[model samples]
Target: GQHAELDVMRKVEGVAISPRDTVLVDQGMMTGRAGIFAGGDVIGGLMTMTAATGHGKKAARAIDVWLSGGHYEGHEKSPPVDFDMLNLPLFLDAGRSQMSALPPEARSGFVEVVAGISDREARYEADRCLSCGNCFECDNCFAACPEQAVVKLGKGRKYTVDLDLCTGCAVCYDQCPCHAIEMVADVAALSAEAHRPLRFKARP
Candidate 1:
């Protein structure tokens, strides 16, 4: 038996080969089979449990979007937001609040060990939630725009640019995390369907 190798994947390998195994995937997990999604060790990227778990969630969302007459282009990654990106003057290193802990005697029981923070501490933590490569409606654009071209739509709505008023100054784009906004030919008139800036330009 030393000469023989265990081929557990033998049954499935070379069975559903499409676009020659390595070139068919549209995003990564998608195979040639319609409505079928894949992940885990079978997909062969990271091949780790954590990567597979992430793929599972990604594939689930992809399937949902495909069923709903749309496509999920995968999670849009942004530049890492570090301390240098933030206004350092605003952060005084006041230190983080401690979470309420349960004593050893209380831990002896089956009850939850960690207790919740106070209302004030909770609010303080909530306030610290930064926009950070994602828009949280900080209203910085509204306040910074001298031309008033950028309009805040408030809760449950998105910001809009009045092209008639907008001078393409890029102040709004510059203010609200350039990592979040892509500078296109026309800042306000970019294609809604454009999924991030494609590194390889599309051919005619």
Candidate 2:
């Protein structure tokens, strides 16, 4: 029955089959060679609504391009609309809804099933994030450095240790409230791990 169905379908006009069927189908449909491209569970191995929509959109854009002699440059320069400004109620403090899972026995056969959070719940969870203080280097060590050897990197004011003036006094390490600074040996020798014992030699 399946062979007969295949033979009947193959006999349809404008059908072209090749050994590299996947590549040929994709190129033909996506490039607008046939004016339209479509396939489902039978023609394409993976059958999903998401994949079908993506293929359809690609084919539509290709057709538009061909009809316009490829002259249209779609959406060249428009500043991105700030999504935050959308201020949808979806962004407000509503928590997500819990989903119920299907039992193992009930989900034995092929079926489309999904568990997703409600919009309200998703927004409430997002509101819990702490957008707190400056993202770059913390200000604790910068404020505490007695020698003023640390340099402010930028407008956000992240600090970096200046090697030229640093005396390796370890004062910055001790004073930093946030513990952002640590004193290590100078740049000459880079060690992956700190040497356990300082190799001290008397200078003549």
lDDT of each: 0.58, 0.47
Candidate 2 wrong stretches, greater than 4 Å: 1-9, 12-14, 18-23, 26-33, 39-46, 69-90, 93-97, 101-204
Model 2 collision count = 3
Clashing pairs in 1: none
Indicate which candidate wins on TM-score: 1
Worst 10 residues of 1 by lDDT: 195-204
* TM agreement with the true structure for every prediction: 0.47, 0.30
Q: Cα RMSD (Å) per model? A: 10.5, 17.1
lDDT (Cα, tens digit) per residue for candidate 2, span 16-58: 5545343235542531234434454335555576676766665
lDDT of prediction 1: 0.58
